[model samples]
Each structure stands twice: as C-alpha cells, then as structure tokens.
Target: MSASAKKQSIYEPDQEGLYFPRPPVFSTVAEERQHRRERLAAVCRIFARYKFEYGFAGHVTVRDPEHPGLFWTNPFGMSMSRVKASDMILVDHVGKVVEGTWAVNQAGFVLHSAIHEENPDIIASCHAHTVNGMAWAALGRPLDPITQTACGFFGHQAVITEEAGAVVVERGAGFAVAKAFGDSKVAIHQNHGLFSVGRHSIDEAAWWFIALERACEIQLKAEATGSPLKLVAPEKAAHSAKHLATPFMGWLHFQPIYDWIIRTDPDLVD
Candidate 1:
C-alpha cells in the first residue's frame, strides 16, 4: 500500500479498492429489525463469553426499527449464553411482551423501556451485574481518568445516586435512571453496576458495557494498592475521549467479537 493509502481513514477504501468494514445499510425496516435482533443475540453470547452473566441479572436491548416504542431483548430466565435471535422477545414500554412466546424480565423492561421512551435517539442499552462493575459501584464514584482506556469515559459517564441499589422494577426507579443517563454513554449506579447506552447500534452499547467493566476492574485494583494513582491530564483525557468514546468506534471495536461469536456459535442466529 502507498503512504497515502496507509494515511487514509479506516472508513475509506484502500489503494487496492478494498473497502473497510462499516455498518450495513438496509433497504427495508424488516431487514433492519432482523439485523438488530441478530446483533442483539450475538451481544448476549458475547456477554456470556466474558462471564458477565450472574443468574440472569443482565439484559441488552435494541429498539425495533418498525416500532420505535418496542424493543427486543433476551427472554426472562434464558441464559445469555443460550439466547438466539428467535429467543428474543419484543416488549413495549409498558412492560408487555407484545411478541414472542417467552416472558420478559420486569426489571429489564422497566429500566430499558424507560430509557428508550425517554431518549428516542438511543438505539440500544445494556446493563449487567458484573463482579468488577458492582465492586467499583460500591464506592459510589465515577471512574478517574487514570489510564488511556478509562479516559474514554472521562466526560461521558455519570454516577447515578437515586435508587442506586434498589431493584429497578418500579417505574419511578427506571425514570430516575433515565434522567441520570442524559446524553451520557455510560452511568455507574451507586452500589449497583454499569449501564451503557448507544445511539447507533447494539454493538456500541455492548462494547461499552464490556469496556466499562474492565475499567472498573482496573480502577479497583489500582486503588486497592493504597498508592496514589496518577491521573491523566484533563485536556489530554478530553482529547482521548473525543476519539475513543465515539459510538462509531464502539461499534467498530465489537465487529471482531461479533464475527467470532457468529462463527463459533452459529446457532445464535436461529
């Protein structure tokens, strides 16, 4: 490849006229909805691969392209590892499973529904009770920009305190979370866990959740050493976040993981 080809943006075609990976464009709403469902199912499998499951205390959702008020999520009681496109349930904002044989998780519906309802621009959301995320949440604080990875969330994350540890089955609790999540990519609920949203795709939401969990783990380990961890400068951290925390970058980062899951667990498309 020529130097100019190497300098070209990854989103552009190479000198050989080979195109880089990009989000698929669908010609119809049905095709987009199906694509979202398949991606959502793959995200659950990816979460399971990271061992993010804890007795069904997790959910990821993608808004339906045809029905904006209804979203698709894994059925209640289904293992994240076993969720497939067909196993996903379509749920309305009122907590009803409008389509699908399986029931929905009330907590998941309450939280995710409120988010989708309140933020119509958000295309996807994810929440899970991962060990590291919960551990860091116990501190009731936002992550410090101590590393390049953590810097992605520098200005784009919030620490939600209202009803933080409460089971989010109540509409009010859900609304509280939605209010706190204003324009942020991720929120840390005090004494609870991580919640991430994506304005582009399920891939973005899922990848951010995974990245936030790792950030939590890193911070927890660093603070556990009782040493003063050096923090990234505010200006540099902001610049890093601008480039690293974009919705497109989040989606791009998950493509390899999505490919691996679909290739190894082909049944997820069923």
Candidate 2:
C-alpha cells in the first residue's frame, strides 16, 4: 500500500467512533430536549476539560422551564468526561426517574431538586469539587473577592456552614439547602463543595467556573503573602452583583464562550 493510503487508513474514524453534528438551532420539544442533552454534555465536558468535576460524584442540573417538576442530570456513577446527552436522565421532584433510562444519583435528589423546586428563577445548577472550591469549603468560610475574577460572586455567595451528614439520606436536606441559598445565586457547602444557580445552563456554568477559579486564585495569593487577606466591603460586593446578575452581561459574556465550545465540538449535542 502507498504511504499516503496507510496514513489515511490510520486517520479514518472507525464505525463506532463517528458522531453526529449538532444542529445550529432547536425549535421543538424534541429539539429542546436534544439541546438540553447537549447542554448537559457540554457541562460535563467542560468540567472534564478544566478538571472541575468530582470523580463518579458531583452533579449539574437544568430545570425544564415548561415542566417545573422535572429536570435533567448526569446518571449515577457516570464519569464526567464521558457523559453524553443520551446519558442524561430526567427525574421528578420526588427523585423518581421520569424520562431517562438511568436512576437519579443520591446527591441529585438531595441538592438539585430543592433548588429547582423552591426557586422559580433558578433554571440551571452546577455542583463540583474543584481543588480551590473544596479548600474554601473545608475552611467553612464564604468566598471573598480577593481579585477581579472573584467579582462575579461579589454579593451572591452563601455559606452553608452546616450540612447535615449524608444529606442524601436525611429527610428535608434538599429543602435545607434551598433555604440556605434563599435568593442568592451561589452556595458553599462547607466541607463538601460549591453550588451555583443560574437562569440557564450557561449562567450556572459561568458562576461555578468563576467561583472555583476565584477560590483557587485567592488561596494561592493568600499563601504567598502570608498575611491577613482583605475583602471588598459587603455593599461594594452587592453593587457588583447587581450588574453581574443582569441578563445582558451574562449572555454577552457566557453565550459566546458556550457557542464556541458547541461549534468546536458539536457532537456534544448528541
């Protein structure tokens, strides 16, 4: 065989390796579900790309805007790197699987359901155990803006200092998490990890992304200075949050980034 032919054979995709490309837009319920599946896959893929997802654990959820009682999440025990839109399962507020083939993970029942049920404005949620996020969570402290990157979380962070042991098993634990977040967009589950709420998948993903990166940066800078860290005043933080919470900013900032990811890896939509 020619050298070029051999090279072509080596580079060609196998039958099972081929993937379908995502459509440019979605216009129906099926298309929307496909979009949600793709969005969930993108969340998982981004986590894996940034090493943000917890192994065999952690979760991200999106509320069905039309069906308030149902949402999509990663199937139990799936690796964040390999999660597909087809792998996502739909579960009701009571934790029963409504649409997908897999069962709801325990943490999904305990953490996401309550957030979705209580907060009508919250359309998507992301939970993860990135090193910096875990460090702050372990310290049992709320995140503080030590840099401009942390500005996104300025006043929207809540510290859930007391998470009941085995929240998934305990009754009302989900509701408790909802209460802690209240109207805030972020929650730090002490000794556990971080949770973010958004008006859409991109919104929540951006919150988690900024919060985790900020936590990591703060910890690194604090260690270098070996001195007490200063935090922006609450009022200032609140003011910044007001601007960050506006839809225009989030869409402008995040949609382009998310669109880039979709364009580069359109198969995630499948």
Once model 2 is optimally superposed onto the true structure by TM-score, how far is the C-alpha of residue 21 displaced, in angstroms?
Answer: 21
Question: Where does the lowest 10-residue lDDT sum fall in candidate 2?
Answer: 2-11
* Clashing pairs in model 2, backbone N/Cα/C closer than 3 A: none
What is the TM-score of candidate 1? 0.94
- Whole-model lDDT per candidate: 0.90, 0.69
Could you tell me how far off, in angstroms, the CA of residue 184 lies in candidate 2 after the best superposition? 0.7
lDDT of 2 by residue, 73-129 (tens): 888887877788888888888788888777777765677888887887777888877
Candidate 1 C-alpha lDDT tens digits along 1-270: 445543323455445656567788999998999899999999999999999999979998899998888889999999999899989999899878889999888976798888889999999999988999999999999999999889999999999998878888899889988988888999999998999999999999998999999999999999999999999999999999988888888988899999899999999998
